[model samples]
Target: MIDFKVLSDYAATFTHSENDLLRQMEEKAAEIYIPIMQPSAMAFLQQLIRWRSARKILELGTAIGYSSIRMALAAGNDTTIVSVERDEAMIEEATQNIEALNLQERIQIVAGDATDDLSEVASAAPYDLILIDAAKVQYEHLFEKCSGLLADQGIIVTDNVFFHGLVCDIDAVQKKQLHRLVKKVDAFNHFLSEREDFDTIFLTVGDGMAVSTKRSCAEGER
Candidate 1:
């Protein structure tokens, strides 16, 4: 197999350069050790939004609203995003970032645990696209909640499915906590692959991404 890291780096050279605001956000996220989406993966995500013309997007995790902002910008001016984050600090920063871009109307940050009841999120049912980039251990739980909120033929994209390639070699992980997290991520991959209601594909995009499209009832029945 080709060296993916090298290939990804080379491919990123062709993607559009980050603007001043995005560049600043990238720098700040790096300085603070905030885990934002890789540029390559983010490019793929933006393309998905453009391809689907996604108008309503729900992001399970909003670290600093980086991905949410990117999606809104690509999905068109009419697009709206509802992002959930439990961390108070992160939510504050993300809100500031969204406001800085004058995207307050396009992106709304909901303060709460994604795994818990989000009545506000539920009220805005049937999102066209849902991005899951939350805690690895709770991926399945998040998926369950997102499934019901997804519109017919909607897509759910899960990030960090590979867990830094550790899922491929769990035995190599010495830390028990990390090992358990990797195992859970691996199990979620299996669970998602076997889902009856959606057709899923795993991509080698940055840190690995899993894109699943809801199958129509007729297709599921068949």
Candidate 2:
């Protein structure tokens, strides 16, 4: 196919404006150039969890804990979040943020490469919801690793699947700053679409988001 992206109801995707906390922190992250999920996307995530009745949530990136915190608060008392971040500094800030929210018991932050040794993080696996927003090239690896960790009815939601619209035609974006990202997202999308274990849907949102659910998993897998 010429276009890697299938047309989606752009208007209906996690559609909502920024809330107060989202607006304020988004400004702060911008001041420091600390990337976080857009408010609209977070808003959608909130809807997603509520609709999916998410009980356990796993996040691949914890840039400033903005989205993590948002997800936790929106999930309420029953939900627990385990977010992974590679950067030490980011982890420190996220730790403090989690504590400040009095969510130390509800949210856990792990420090280390998310893909390097998931064996440790795997303890939190079989998650009902998994949100990935870290390194672009590792999307496929994360998906595979997280698959066995997902519950039967779990969903894996990934952000930045478009990579600034480059995923559609890497030849044109190969020379751009986002060339590698575009190529990787395309690779991940291609890999997922062919898999029978999961049902995947790619939506064009902030950068882009792909929501996949574990369908009939392969033999010897969950």
Candidate 3:
């Protein structure tokens, strides 16, 4: 069996080292124990943006704006990113980080519950790409909401679907609350797998990422 840790470490060696500002944000995120996309997964996301030429992007979580900034950079100057965050502290920090890079015009931070009415988000409909990395329990809800706003052939990328490997062994999760959360994550994965409208592929990169794209009518018929 392949050692995932070793594989991840090896993959890290191939990824570009983050620039100084991103490095500082990463350090701060680590020191404060904030959840951000793993470097390998982040690199994969950037690659997707470049390959797809995704100009309009939507992110469910704006944790310090790390991933948003990364996506903006990868998508080039033509990209516009709308990132939503409920936490005031996270929004403030993310705004500062985005401004530090003078990316205010490129990235917009929306403040509110992502699972709630996303009328503002819908206004920018038909996004070229959508990224979900918010609450684990609300993954399904978020997915359902974001699907409506995705472009015809656009992709939806979800992070932390594995929930630190806990979803792989729900019974082994000692804490009751954590076990419940793990079960929810596991259910969401199954839900994604069973969806008929989209073709979802699971990758074991960075906890786990589920990349889903809308299926064409002929593909759906198959």
Candidate 4:
């Protein structure tokens, strides 16, 4: 079943010591009013990257570089993460944070609208792991791009499919843009499940995630 919810409050007293660098960045994100990937979500992603021994990773959103850095730390040596962000403000801040961590060589920060021109950015045919967490309305297109760029047994993980529980109750969020985006996300969630080429599992973590892996050639290309 698709579910969303994480244990513990994001801002707790002693949990600040898990990763000092990460904690510092999260605090800074808060100070600057930047949204970040949830801790539970981060942990899940890190575990996946470790298991896959992912060398090449792609991220659609790089807000303050929290997730990208955490993934880098999780994978240790020789891991490359390319994160894309459209906002100049976030890019400037994320650049500073990444440089401060001395991860310039390991991580390549791409500045552009993720939906617009990713095809020209990286010529690599396949990435081992792809993480999606950005504009909700663009996920359908992102999924198409991700599917084209994924390698054998590659996995796709999307965050915020639950959309703060707004997917089920569109009226909860009256903002025109957000409400429409919620509808698109809901449709994508449904589409992922119906695809015979993938086996999707939705785990209960921060904001909900849809984890989809392409069926092997044995599955006969559903």
- Per-residue CA lDDT of candidate 1, range 1-222, in tens? 867677767766666634678878887886988988878899999999999989999999999889998998898889879999999989998988888889999998999999988888998878999999999899999999899999999999999998888999999999999999999999999999999999999999888999999998788889
Q: Write the per-residue lDDT of candidate 3 for residues 68-114, one digit (tens) a residue.
A: 99999999998889999999999999999899998999999999999
Candidate 2, superposed: residue stretches over 4 Å from native: 1-21, 174-177, 216-222
Off by over 4 Å in 3: 1-3
Q: What would you estimate as the lDDT of candidate 1?
A: 0.91
Candidate that beats the other on lDDT, 2 or 3, i.e. the better one: 3
- Top candidate on TM-score is 1
Listed per candidate, the RMSD to the true structure in angstroms reads: 1.3, 4.3, 1.5, 3.2
lDDT, candidate 2, 54-125, per-residue tens: 979999999878888888877888878989998998999888877876788888888888787665578877
RMSD of 4: 3.2
The TM-scores of all predictions, comma-separated, are 0.96, 0.85, 0.95, 0.87
Q: In what order do the candidates fall by TM-score, top score first?
A: 1, 3, 4, 2
User: What tens-digit string does per-residue lDDT give for candidate 4 at 1-222?
Assistant: 433332424423223334677788777766876778766777888888888898888899998888888888888879878899999988998898888889888788888998876754467547888899888888988988788788777888999888777888877888998888888988999999998777899876677789999777887443
**Candidate 1 weakest lDDT stretch, 10 residues:** 10-19
| Candidate 1 colliding pairs | none
